[model samples]
Target: MILLRNLVFALFFGIGSVVIVGLAPVSALFGQRAMIRHATAWTRFHHQLVRWVLGIRVAVEGERPSGPALYAAKHQAMWETLELQMRLDGAAMVLKRELADIPVWGWAALRYGAIPVDREASAAALRQMIKDARRARAQGRSVLIFPEGTRVAPGETPPLKPGFAGLYGALDMPCVPVATDSGRCWPRKGLKRPGVITLRYGAAVPPGLPRRDAEALIHAGINALERRA
Candidate 1:
């Protein structure tokens, strides 16, 4: 039953995505942001469908970060990204610029304050990301950072990248560390795994002092999630 549902959704969204991407650029030229908004909302709706398809329930723990704190989280699965929109009243993600190349969804993300980073971590790329993030935060949006940069194998912890710590250092706002193991069921690629994913939101690290301190604290988050798995 789970496999069948996953397959159905995969087909439906996969095809629909093409249409949204194709139409988005033209819509943006006219400043018609509705399509992007629809795509964003649709993607979230799609995720809910995915949850039902796989019979996976997601539960978030602890308090959601308040104010413009840098939100650092584990990157074990893509589920964490989608779940944020529905879970938080206002949440933003620091994602790759390639996502912005997509049509409707990318346009909507820009409209909704999503920060896009460069693929190859370079000084210029990081600078652009920081600039974009700062702008978004100035507008009063919470930024979410997946410090590992890439998804690691289930139960494995990747080295915490300096970008997270650097961002933490540059921004004097509080930082929140969250942990999860959604990848055990949902492989990075292939059919979605069955059952609900459990997520634990750890406490916020008050912003002060220097950046190196963030590495230890962020690494602790990576370790904590691995322990949960």
Candidate 2:
């Protein structure tokens, strides 16, 4: 039954994704707001798929960050990726460059104002990310980044990547650290389990702090999600 359920979701996800991406040209004709709306709608649809098909419920704890801010979050599974739109409307996510290279999906992501980074992790890449992130803020879209760069298992704890700190310092906006236990139900790989996924938003770490201090705060906050679970 689990395998059948997973397959059903996988098929729906693939087709639905392509359909959403195919709307890129039409969304462009209407402008940024249209693109953002389409992106948010797509995410909401995904939320329904997991809830109804896969039986995974979602709940958000603590306060939702508002206005222009940088959201540093824990990376658990693909679930949290889609769940971001639920937390923040029209969120400009920090993603990998490879995802931007896809056919229609990549183009739609660019139109939606997502910030893509190189996996090679160079000095120039970091600089470009900061530039794009600042531009996203100027456009009035909030930013969401996975401080760990990649997803990890529920109990495993990893150091927050340096790109997070660079963006925090360069953007100079209040950083809101988010933690989630989605991986317990939606693992980074393998079988899917059914349970409630909780996203906890911590207090904002305001700007003007030293790099080390900011990094420490984000790291501790994100890892705290695991401890709570």
Best by lDDT: 2
Backbone collision count in every prediction? 3, 0
For candidate 1, write residues 63-150 as lDDT tens digits. 7655667888787777778766555544668888898777656776676677788867789888878887787678676778889888
Report lDDT (CA) for all predictions. 0.72, 0.87
Strongest candidate by TM-score: 2
Q: Model 1: which ten-residue window has the lowest total lDDT?
A: 30-39
Please give the range of 10 consecutive residues that has the lowest summed lDDT in model 2: 220-229
Model 2 per-residue lDDT tens digits across residues 101-203:
9987888889888899998779999999999999998988789999889988887788888899899988878999898898888886788877898888888
Model 1 lDDT, residue 168, Cα: 79
**Which residue pairs collide in model 1, if any?**
56-195, 56-196, 57-196
Give Cα distance to truth, residue 25, candidate 1, Å. Answer: 6.9
Clashing pairs in 2: none
